[model samples]
Structure formats: structure tokens, C-alpha cells
Target: MRNILVVNGSVSGDASVSRALVEVAVQRLLGINPDASVTHRDLSHGAVPHLTPATVAGVRAVANTDHELSTQALSDELIAELQAADVVVIGAPMHNFSIPSSLRAWFDHVLRRRVTFSYSEAGPKGLLTSKRRHMRSFDPPW
Candidate 1:
């Protein structure tokens, strides 16, 4: 089964233009792929885990004897989903000329070593195929 992860970058809930646009594109893709499964991650709806001292520590720990720091940085569930997803749909909106904080948190979790990316002789290679990235940027649109 192909997994399609739709990342709604809107920090103002689903009502945001970016999320709405992403929803429309996601629905259209679903219409074309009835057998496909979709995971809609709404960042504005409290889905983002805060980056505390422990969380930051965990993300940086590669061989921590304790799981506390690692768990705080990235959850098993999210890492698994991110690694398994066949495609990622990103809704990028400008918030003060930058991506939203919630979206940044999502990136932090998704963009990990030996998971989402890896180093090779040709520089860093994306674990995810370039074709898997379906991005739509707008002037506050998805």
C-alpha cells in the first residue's frame, strides 16, 4: 500500500489557505487513487511536539544508554511513519518570511540521519526519493 503523508503547514488550523489547498490536492490524488491511504498531519491542531531540553538532547543522542532523550526528540510512531511514507505533500506558507514553527518541528522530526537522509560519496542523499516530494508553494497557498 502506498502511503501519502500530507503535511498541512498552516499554523492557523484548517481554515488557513495553505491547508485548504493541500486538502484539495490530497483529495484529487485520492480520487485518482482509490486504493491509496493518506495520513493528514495538521500541524496547527496541536500535533507538533514541543522541543524541550530533553527533546533536543534526544535528537542529538545516537547511542544514549537511556531512551528518554531520544524519545523526547523524536517519537517512534512519527519516525516510522516518515520512513514508511511513499510520498510527502508539503504545504509551505510564509510566516514572517519563514515556515511556521509547527512545520519546522515536523521537519525536525522527519529530517533525521539514517532515516530521512544519508551521506554518500556524492554528498548527502535523500532517503526519500526525489519523486516522492510533491510540493506546492504559494503566496500563502498550499
Candidate 2:
């Protein structure tokens, strides 16, 4: 079974354009793939940890469990979800004519150098290869 990670990059809990867009897409995605599963990670619901020195160190220790970092249990869960995705769909809004910060944070969490990408003579390369990439936006013309 395929797992699709749907990241809702809206800052507001209610009346967010990104949330609406993601909802519609999630429904359509469900219709298209009956067997596939969808996981929703809301950028702004209650709270999510900010990527700090402690958090970064925690991520680095995932490979070797002996050397641990942050004691928060959610860090391990978050890292696993990111690495296990079969595809990633981000619902982003142009804040100040640019993508929202949470989406950027999501990238920071997932786009680790050795974990999610590789540096080669040909330059940087993506470690994960998925079938679909859907980035939708709803912002006033700017």
C-alpha cells in the first residue's frame, strides 16, 4: 500500500486558503487511489516544534540509536513519517508573494543532506523518488 503525505502549509486554523485547497485535493486523491492511504500533517493546528539546535541534533542521531539527542518522543515519529512517504503533496499559500514558512520548515525537516539527498560529482540529487508532485497555491495577485 502506498502512503501519500499531505502537508497543509497554512498558518491559520480557520479560513485558510491552503487548507481548503488541500481538503479538495485530499478528496480527489482518495477517489483516484482507493487502496492508497493519506496522512495529513497540518502546519498550524496546535503546535509543532521549531527546528533548533536541539532538534537538528536529534535528527542526526536517528541512524545510531546509542547516541541520542532531544528527549522528545515526537522527534523520532516525525522523522520516520518523513522518510516513509511514497509521495508528497504540499498545499502552500503565497504569503507576501512567497511560500509560507511552515512549508519551508517542512522542507528543512525532510531535505536532510545525507538522509534525503546526496551530493555527487553531478551535484545534489534527491534520495526519494515519487510518482507525483502537486503544489497548489491560492493568493491574491502579487
Candidate 3:
């Protein structure tokens, strides 16, 4: 069975065009793979904590010593979702000509050292092998 991770980054909730597109994409995936399981991470509703010094410390602790820090649980959960997913879909709307802060926070949580990536002799390498699909919606100027 395929495991799909859908990340909703639009703060407009149900009114977001990006989210509506995501719904359509998810439905199509479900139609194609009836046994597929989906995990939804709604960033607008429950935004990931911003990467502060404490959060950085937590990431370092996990990478270096495998120790649990204050934000360890949340980070672990996010990493686990990424690791378990066979496909990942991100819905991000262009806000101020860039991605939303909530989506950036989500990326901060997932892009951890020794979790989503690691430093090799050449450079940093992505650990995730899952297929990723990104959907962006923009409002036209009136």
C-alpha cells in the first residue's frame, strides 16, 4: 500500500485555491491506488514552531547524541511522516511573491541534520527518496 503525505500550507483554509487543488490531486491518487493511506499535515491550523535557538539545540542533540530535547517529539513525528511516505504533496500559495511562513516552518522541522539530509564528502545530500509534488496557486492582478 502506498503512503502519501499531504502538506497544506495555505492560511486561507478552505478558501485557498492551493488547498482545493491539493484535494483534487489527493482524490485522483486515491482513485488510482485504492489501498493508499494518506497523512495530512495542516500547517495553517497547526503551524510548526519556528526554528529558534532552542529548536536548533534540539536538532543538534538528536543528531549528535540521539537525545530527546524539548522539541524532539515534534521533530521526530515530522521526520517519521517524511520517512514513511512513498509520495509527498505540498500545497503552497504564493504570498508576497514567496511561500508562506507556515510552509517555511514545516520545512525547517523536516530538514534536519542526519534526518532528512547529511553532510557527505562532497556536500549535503537529501535522505528522502520519496516522490514529491508541489502545487502553487497565485491570484491574478485585477
Give me the candidate number with maximum TM-score. 3
Which whole-number lDDT from 0 to 100 does residue 136 have in model 2? Answer: 56
Which candidate comes out best when scored by lDDT?
3
lDDT of each: 0.68, 0.65, 0.77
Backbone N/Cα/C clashes per model? 2, 0, 0
Window of ten residues with lowest summed lDDT in model 1: 133-142
lDDT for position 54 in model 2: 43
**TM-scores for every predicted model:** 0.76, 0.73, 0.82
Writing each residue's lDDT as its tens digit, candidate 1 over 24-140 gives 777777777878889877777656665665455555445354555555445555766776777777887898899878888877766677766889999998876644443554342
Ranking of candidates on lDDT, top first:
3, 1, 2
lDDT of 1: 0.68
Q: Which sections of candidate 2 miss by over 4 Å? A: 62-68, 71-76, 133-142
> 1-142, model 2: which lDDT tens digit per residue?
3787788778777887667766676666667777878888887753455566546655554533322354234455665676677766777778888887777766665666676678999999887665445455434322
TM-score for candidate 1, residues paired by index: 0.76
